[model samples]
Every structure is written in structure tokens, then in C-alpha cells.
Target: MITKKQIDNNTLSDEEIVKRIVNGESYLYEHLMRKFNLRLFRISMSIINDEMEADDVMQTAYINAYMQLSNFQHKSSFSTWLTRILINESLLHKKRKLKQTQLLAAQTDNEYSNDNPLRRLMNKELKVILEKAVSTLPEKYRLVFVMREIEEMSVNETMEILNLGESNVKVRLNRAKEMLRSELSIYYKTNEVFEFNLIRCDRVVNFVMNKINKES
Candidate 1:
């Protein structure tokens, strides 16, 4: 009932794609996953602050979204609904990771500083530092920052996804920028940060497709 041209050319709206997928064109789901992979990864990274964990969260979120696709009511755009699901998954995963970290701390003789994950970058290129700067933002501001600035979404879209009022979204975004040191502003490029490269996209798409197919 589907053809390669439809997938390759992306001729359908997201809502149209979702409607078909729910009606038995399940393979069409790959299109949706590949489309939002980058956006979802960055949003999840804003909260998880760890690349590996962010990928893991994104994977789980995609699976959860697919399984619950029938319940989607078209109240919001597909991206907004998917984003809400990702945010919830990210928050739950962060809470669980924190609990695990705290338990490990209690079991050991060492003190805990509650620091963000630290790594020794071989070189502090603008791209690398920009990523570090965003990753280090407090969770509240970080989510708003990614949705508004990096994703270049409108105020209403960001507000809907984040459940924030228009003024609150603006305030949080401004605050997120302020938290980044002045020096970092000299070299700005959001796309360079949290990139989900081609190979990564293929792996995720293949993985999600395989899981969804098994359900059919």
C-alpha cells in the first residue's frame, strides 16, 4: 500500500503519516523517527547532560511514542506530542540516575559534589566549548534554551512543548543565554552542538524499525 517515492520524497504531512501508520502502514514510522532524531536527541541531552544517556533516552522515547501512537488525539502537532513524551522520559531517567548516583555515594567513603559529567576534551574548539556550556546549564534553563534557541521553534510552539507561558519561555531563554559566559558568545553555532551524525541516524532508524516491525 506504500511506495519508496512516498518515503524518499516525504510528500505527506506528519499528521497524515501518523494516520497511515495507525491504519496499518506501520513501516512509514521510519520516516517520522529519522525526521525528528536530531531534535529529540538535543532536547534529551539538555536534561541528561550525557551524550550516551541522551541517546538511550531518545531511543526509549521513540519506542514509547510508537507503542502509544493510537492514543494520539491530534491536539498538538506530532512534533510537540513527541517532544512532550521525550521530556517526560528524560526527566524520569534523570531522576533514576540521580537516585543511583546517590546510592553509590552512600555506599562509598567518598564525598559527592553533584557535578555535571566531566571529560577532558583534547582541544577546546568553539564547537566543543559551546556544547560544554549548554550541557552545564541547570536543567530548567537548559530545556527552554534548546527548544527556543537551538531548535529555532516559535514562542507558542516552545510554550506548548514545555508547558510554559509565553513570558516564562522568554524569561528562561534569556536566563539560559545569560548563564553562558560572555566569552562564548564570540563564536556561536547551535547546529554544531549535539550533532546526530549520519551513521548515528542510520543506527537509530534501523533499531527502531526493527522493534516496531516485531510488533506487527
Candidate 2:
């Protein structure tokens, strides 16, 4: 398990952390979890369309990745590799969720608390506002937008993650920006929509760490 001091000490590059973790320093995996939580959450939300379900997908992805960390070949950045795992898990979860939705009447409830303040003006409510707008986008463009604009990953990484060519990634990103340009212009203050806050961050880290610890 990661100690308190180790959690705040993230001076290592992700590749170094992975190498060490694979060499038996498994507690270091916590650093990777905290570092990529927000990115995974945002991308998962773009695909999954539900925060809670996105969190669930993220947990499964982390656990699966940890169990298979030895297979990472360093062909891509660790973030890209982990993100690919998250994307696959999210897509599979979405398919299963879609079937369940068809059989069961979907009901939505408003229960997200807005206690965090972004720049003293953009609260969680505003974040939700932008999320709803972004969620309205088609999945292909939504994924492109979240990875390119929101998460700020490089085009090459996004292309590899989405299994698209550079041209296709560029085109989809441009189309996504044009579609959301007018709608998101006013919501500029709240650029970060699907933020993975610390509370939820700890919950996910603890869940994954505990699961891996038990299995180890």
C-alpha cells in the first residue's frame, strides 16, 4: 500500500513509476491512479454518459491494468496505454448498460453536490451545465473533444487511442470544436466539466489499492 508521504511525492515520471511497479514496488501504482484519474474520468464520461458509471469503469480499468502491467511494452506513453484500457472497459460497460437500459425504464435523479468552487464562480452546477451540453454531442466527436480539448492530450495519442489516423483525429476534433464553439463560448469560465475531485479520487484509489493488495 502507498504511504501518506509517498502519495504527495510524485516527482517520478509515469514511465519510471511503471517500471518500478512492475519490478515489485506495486504500491507505486497509486501514483499513476491519482495522476490520470481526471483524464480517465473525463474520457469515460464522454463515452459512458454517467459519472457514477464512469467511476465504476475507471475502477475496473485500473484493476485490470494493474493485473496486466507486465505486458506494457513502452511503445506508447503510460497515459496512452492506461487510457486505452479505460476506453475499452468503458465501451464494454456502455454496451452492457445499453442493454440494461432497454429492459429497464431509465430514471435520472439530481443529487450531485456543488460544494467545490472553480475560480470562485464556476461551481459544480456550472460544470454539470457544460457536461450536459458536451454530452449532447455524437460519441465520436465527443470522445475526440474530450481527449483533445478537455484533457489536452496530443493528436497522435488521441489518434492511437481512438484507432483513427492523424487526419481523422484532426477532422473530428475540428468538427467537435465547431459544433460546441457557440454553445461553449459562454461557458468558458468552466472549461473543466467532468472534474474528478479529491474526495472521489481517494475513493477510487482506495478501492483499487485494496483490491490489488488483497489479490497480491
Candidate 3:
């Protein structure tokens, strides 16, 4: 895996990298791929809930991106532009796999997903319980929540990725938060308290950001 130090040492800025890619210095594009793969995977996974499919979505998005590279207008951050493509790819996969009954089944089963060992020590046994609750959210709400809350993307960036307007994003985010809070309330017995440790998740955030940056 490429390290941040390696990324920082790379010679080209994003625009420069794009120019190089467009000029047929195709190998430089691999550097971008390495940068953004993780972040894109996370987004794709949040939508599809299938690891292999998420990987496929990321790969397909890149292929589509490379073919359309000449059309990139620099209107949005390169990261946002690439992410939007992946988001669409993931959603398309969801649509193809869509079944009303299966969606309901996944929602009902969301409460029993895996627990990260570290999370147990950080919070109560109920940490994964809350996560499961979030998992049960409708796909639309779930995607927005994960992008904004877990990925910590800015509203504008999210709007670009989700192809939503500012007001729509806000509305969905608010509803998602409300649903999460309500579910957590029940999971915690309405008495057990838990504090989120931002510091612990910093590495995850950095990892995702670097993946996107490199994959770009």
C-alpha cells in the first residue's frame, strides 16, 4: 500500500497529474488510483453492502472516468468529480439488484452485524448495536448519513457526489440523524452513555482521503 509520505513526495499536483494523464503519460494515473480507492470503496460499500460489488463499482467508475477524462472541466474538485462517478456506479448496482422484499429483510437484520473489537472498549457493548441501527436506514438516507457523518464530507461535496441540491441534502441528513439517534437511544437502554472519540477515527478519515486523492 502507498503511504502518505510517498504520496506527498510525488511530483505532480492534481491538475498537473490530469494534464499528464491526458497527454498519454498514462502511468501517472495509477498514482491517482492508489490515492482514492479506499474512500471510493467505503462509499460504494455503504450503498451496496457487498464488498466485491463495491470493488467492482470503484473499478468501473475509474474505467468510465479514464474514458471521459477529456470531459473533466475542473468545475468541482477532482476528488468530488471522481466520487460522483463512483456514487452513481454504486447506486446503479443497487438499482439492478433492487427487490422490495430484500431491502426490507436487510433493514430488519441490520441490528446484528459485526462488532469491531476496539469499539467495544471505547464504548459499551452497544456500539455495534447503534451501527446496526444506522445500517437499517433506507438506502438514500443511509448513503447521505455515511458520507456526511462517517466520511465527514462537506455539504457541498456531498451534494456533488450524491447529485442532490443543498436543501435536499440537509433534509435527508436531518432525517438520518434523527433515525440514528432514536435507534441509539433504544440500543443504549436510554440510560447507558457513550462518547464518540474523534481522535480514534482520524486514521480512517485520512486513509479514505488519501485513497481518493491517489485514485484520482
The estimated TM-scores of all candidates read 0.49, 0.45, 0.43
**Taking the candidates one at a time, how many backbone clashes does each contain?**
0, 0, 10
lDDT of 3 by residue, 60-150 (tens): 9999999988889988878898999999988988887787668877875553334454544555655667679989899999999999989
Worst 10 residues of 2 by lDDT: 107-116
lDDT of 2 by residue, 1-216 (tens): 577666544677788888888998888887789889999999999998999999999999999999989999999998999999999999999999888876564332212223424433546566787888889789999999999889999998998888999999989888887877767766665655677899889999999999999999
Q: Where does candidate 3 clash, by residue pair?
A: 32-214, 32-215, 33-215, 35-211, 35-212, 35-214, 35-215, 36-211, 36-212, 36-215
Highest-scoring model, lDDT: 1
Which is the winner by TM-score between candidate 1 and candidate 3?
A: 1
- Over 4 Å off, model 3: 1-9, 99-216
lDDT of 1 by residue, 28-134 (tens): 98888888999999999899999999999999999999999999999999999999999999999999999999999776523322331222232335468888889
The collision pairs in model 1 are none
Between candidates 1 and 2, the one scoring higher on lDDT is 1
The C-alpha RMSD of each candidate to the native structure, in angstroms, is 20.2, 20.9, 19.7
Global lDDT of each candidate: 0.86, 0.85, 0.83
